[model samples]
Target: MRAFIFPGQGSQKVGMGTDLAAASTHARELFEEVDDALGQRLFQLMREGPADELMLTENAQPAIMALSMAVLRVLEKEGGVKLADVAGCVAGHSLGEYSALCSAEAIPLAETARLLKLRGQAMQRAVPVGEGAMAALLGADVAKAEDLAEAAEADGEICTVANDNDPGQVVISGHKAAIERAVAMVKDDKDRWGIKRGVPLPVSAPFHCPLMRPAAEEMEKALTETVIVAPSAPLYANVTAEAVSDPALIRSLLVDQVTGRVRWRESVLAMHADGADHFVEIGGKVVGPMVGRIVADAEVMSVQGMDDIEALIKSI
Candidate 1:
């Protein structure tokens, strides 16, 4: 009846998990463990940011996971809530999937932190700066976005829809030229298709398209070398938008997700169909609202700190 979800990359902020670490010993332990695993004080960067360093893909990945896991630990240890008992299923957007897996016990918290750090670094290094970009097409569905992308890919450049986020929000990523072309096309034809907005995202590289195949290959090798276990709760994979329990399948899906469209909209629908009435977003508030838009009748909550966690515990 309840589904716990985790947020991805863009949800991170400078001082995200500080309050949680201050309020709960369990949360503090989670942060300490992540620091030990990564051999660096990621928590320090998260608490006191130089802004630029924390924003780097490599640091952002594990930092976000550390915050989410800290919150999860507080909820379970202090709030007296068991993950297996309260949640029917779990899901997350892109990098959030790693957080969800950690929450489900498919991977240890330390390993999740390390793997996410590697994943972020690989993804960041996959494309050069200014050469690749991503944009959001608001009020446009996947079909229209695809048409626009196809129309804009004629200049020896690659452009493709990357994230099918929700009904009216789709994100495209590829070469900067192709993305610019696609944005122009969308803006030119905005009134014809009821598209009211087209906005470019602030990202260092294009992600989740065929352009990220190198990152996928890198992840494949990294994943094979890492240990993955059957999750305590089913994980709704980003590629399939379906619950996957088998470890091998999860590994394959993680590799595939790099070059595959993140079916976030479909994943929410599938979870709704599977009888999830409540959706709790960990780490940030972005996905909770998106889930609300996808499933209008479902109850949604986002937890960011000790007060929010306490409020959630009381509400649940």
Candidate 2:
């Protein structure tokens, strides 16, 4: 069985999809539609970057989705790979969930782009600059990270484990002071727990923690205005780590995911348990290696461009 996964933020860079757009008319149409929907030239920024403007959450969110969907379209139209026929299940990381839903036909591409734009704006506005922060605790298990978060919270700081990425890799997000405290705790426990140094992330807000509650509330309102249907394939929600198809449930999960932990490790385990033997990462190569670590027996493929797509076609 095969599962298609979409990448989240931090996988984006300048000139991400310019070649794909130029290589195929289908890819070009996808970019044109996204531009029309958002009423801006997002593709231009993606192709030729001042870098800073393109890196903003608001732009990166929709831009990544557009590029991924464009690549998917090229594969479908030129390679004869139908979504329903080739994919058994679909999942995504953070904002990439919106892209997965769009790919699965649960939501249209235009609506997906619009919703992500709003989501990115709301998340960015939830906290001020340099107020909240996120840090990655490398070589630390979930239990140890949670304990560190609790210890940090005892000091009246708001810190919590945000992402259970994989075994020995967890990310904590909250107030900067709390994150600093948690990092200190992790370092202190390094010798005893066999943990390495924690790496701080460069993000505007403390995402996937209580600090994002305001963003969640904003998303609840925005989600209500948008229409989401049952996905063609089950979506492994980041919050639940389980397959969910109900539109109402998906809506609630999307809102909750703002301030909730991203259970990526558990989600991958669940997919593996459900008979997924192949994992195809679309748009970015970042998640592919992570999936390999999480599910060592599974065949993981990262499809980035035409050559990668052709390689994937040959492999399958």
Candidate 3:
């Protein structure tokens, strides 16, 4: 069986979705719809330069979702590969959860765009710039990373694991001082902590930690008012690392996900255990490699543009 996955924030770049928009009318229409929903020329920002603006959390979240949806639209319309027919389940990393739901038809495309825009803004607002930070702990498992975070925490300064990306990589997020202390601990005692290195992330906010409670509250309010339907395929949610289909449960999980650990490693393993041997990543190439790293023999492919879409159609 196959699982369709979506990429998250960091996968975006300056020229994303441009070729798909040019080659497929479905892609073009999807981009146009997203632009109209957010009332901004997001596609132009994605295609043109000015990296700083495109990198903003408000822009990157929806822009990444739009690119993923553009790829899915092309695959459905031009390639005749419906997600419901081909994918046994769906999953996404962080912001990609919205993209996954859009592909599964639980959320409308335009609404997904708008929600992501709001989600990004709320998350950015939850923490002030230069006060929060995240760091990547290389060569460390969740246990080691947690221990490192505990060592770094003190006097109400919060430090906690944000993303358990893989066996070798874990990300932590919290106050800038706590995160800096964690990095320093990893550097000062690499052998003691069993960590090779710690690299601070270039993110605007400390995401997926207790510090994001305010953002979670914001998401809860928005999602409560939004209309959601059951998805065609079950989603392995980031916070739960388990398959969920009920719309209300999905809604609650999404709100919690803002301030919870992204259990990506466990989610991939759970998908593999559930008979999804092949994983297809739509629109971005980042998650495919992570899947390979998680499951040593899992077949993985990433679809980015017309050529990749056509190739995937043939392969499927």
Clashes of each: 0, 0, 0
- List TM-score per model, in order: 0.97, 0.97, 0.99
- Model 1 stretches astray by more than 4 angstroms: none
Candidate 1 C-alpha lDDT tens digits along 44-65: 9999998889988999989988
Which candidate gets the maximum lDDT versus the true structure?
3
Model 2 whole-model lDDT (C-alpha atoms): 0.89
Model 3 lDDT tens row, 224-294: 99899999999999999999999999999999999999999999999999999999999899888999999
By TM-score, how accurate is candidate 1?
0.97
Model 3 clash number? 0
Per-candidate alpha-carbon RMSD to the true structure: 1.1, 1.2, 0.7
Q: Which residue pairs come into collision in candidate 2?
A: none
Per-residue error (Å), model 2, residue 81: 0.8
How large an RMSD does model 3 have? 0.7
Q: Please list the residue runs of candidate 3 whose C-alpha ends up more than 4 Å from where it truly belongs after superposition.
A: none
